[model samples]
Target: MATTEAGIAPRPDQAGLTPLLEVEDLRVEFRTRDGVAKAVNGVSYTLHEGETLAVLGESGSGKSVTAQAIMGILDTPPGFVTGGSVRFRGQDLLALPDDERRAYRGRSIAMIFQDALSALNPVFPVGWQIAEMYRVHEGMSKKDAKNRAIELMEQVHIPAARERAGDYPHQFSGGMRQRIMIAMAIALDPDVLIADEPTTALDVTVQAQIMQLLADLQRERNMGLILITHDLGVVADVADKIEVMYSGRIMEQAPVHDIYASPAHPYTKGLLESIPRVDLKGQELSAIKGLPPNLTNIPAGCEFRPRCPYARDICKEQRPALAEVVPGRFSACHFAQEVLDGDIEPAQQ
Candidate 1:
């Protein structure tokens, strides 16, 4: 069997068969001039080996914030993780010392940001940028690192990788730049990969290619993947589970099929209905009404109540807790059963 770089085979946590990564009751806040903005609130999820968890939400819904917190890259001073624990293989990463925590980054956990151009250095050749990963983490010799970078570029399907290794970041197209980012991210062979909007600016064809490449890599490595995006269409085929977030809170959590089949929360239902359907060509696309609440001064009770068509008086007065609505499915809506059963129309009727 193939082993990790450390010569140890990928194995479950000997302690208790613990998950690869677990975030429990995570809370993140931003201290801006306006006030404290709660970007992530009580977010919790588990990622096991070979599983893909897609965090689906609109802009400013706190999907990216949660991923930033997991990767320990949240901007300090402005962004702070106030509470909760980030456990990897049964150890709380949040509790580790700063220097020790830094060791996990790149080596054990890696991330690919949405903007590849901004993430890569414009001054250096793409190969040197990718080789930096090996040189810094593994302390490999310069020649070996450069050779490895070329190999990685080829693995990601970049044409003439050896010849193009010396090219600057600006020399590549958007999709190729993204592929370079992927090569850098996977260089250390991390056990968990967090891809934050990997296909943001790519065309439809490129988006599908990037998603497929990620899926293939994940299968080959048995790595747990956290795919963060606002596009429901992108994750429909690849994601194993879904977390629908709104107003900095998770509205629903279920298997991919369960969520696509029937959403249990009003917010989730609104999002699903908004996805453009080919069968309904030329018809107006449905959209969730109103904007995401201001995090600094979020409304009392359910944050989604303002936009929820099925919202009742109780919804405005009582904050619904994320509770299990059925076996292996959870929803933070008071009328989850009614919504799932199609008893209540969403943003219509």
Candidate 2:
């Protein structure tokens, strides 16, 4: 599991710009008193250097769980990754010992959590918290670590970073706190960054700022970024590709422009329709009917069948494999082509 001093390399078979990370047939489940809930089922994707992959879905669609599994941060008592592999630079992470895998965190891969307040240690000074990474991981002197923390604070655009380094987590505003979180995550210059709802409660202007900062940092570091969120509009400009998930499965995956222009799955189409559009001003916003299926007891065939307007007997009788509907686009729906062409009206509710 030891990587070279030059760091990780691409898979042997891959030619040209190789992917930085790959997840194949990943499955995770949570064992609860009610039942075993399948959280992530056969989730797979590739992330290349400097690429932005956005995972979009409603809440409970397993976006966060998949990220957690990849990071090796899932709580094991109730949750476990039951199948598949997560490869970083062609190395299978699941096969690594726990200590070896832990070393990769922060140094090779880092995460920006949704809530900065909860993620940060409130009792400690922000600088001390950030400096801890360098001091603990790199064995730097106290003075050097503190100085590095201030440098990172400034890098993230916090004004008066030297002075603010002594400030506690509660002293900074929400946006500034989030920037500190980002600063801490990138301290080791990780090759891959997974941001789980980085702009959850921020205003539109601040949301744009956070996203821009992430993009700028990604470009500067040439890092592969995975942005997980429920809002499609937030990722419209930043994401290179999209994976729309439902009931723990990716219902559709396509280039960002393609998904916006023509979604191939009914579930994806419904998600697009649900977004508020300027042209539809004053008109009631469309919404997907019913709700996501309960993971413990998903429907027999298509998990989305109950809420899908395009559902038919075939949909109820058999599960559709996620297959390429076009050259690059993939969808998990039996009537993918018809749906993409808008050939059939949604069954009347």
Top candidate, metric TM-score: 2
User: How many backbone clashes does every candidate have?
Assistant: 0, 0
Candidate 1 per-residue lDDT over residues 220-321, each given as its tens digit? 898889999988888897888889998889999988988989999988888888878899889999888788899998889898998889988888899999
Tens digits of lDDT, candidate 2, 218-259: 877878899999887887978888889899999998888888
Q: Worst 10-residue stretch by lDDT in candidate 1?
A: 5-14
Per-residue lDDT for 15 in model 2?
Answer: 48
* TM-score, structure 2 vs. true: 0.94
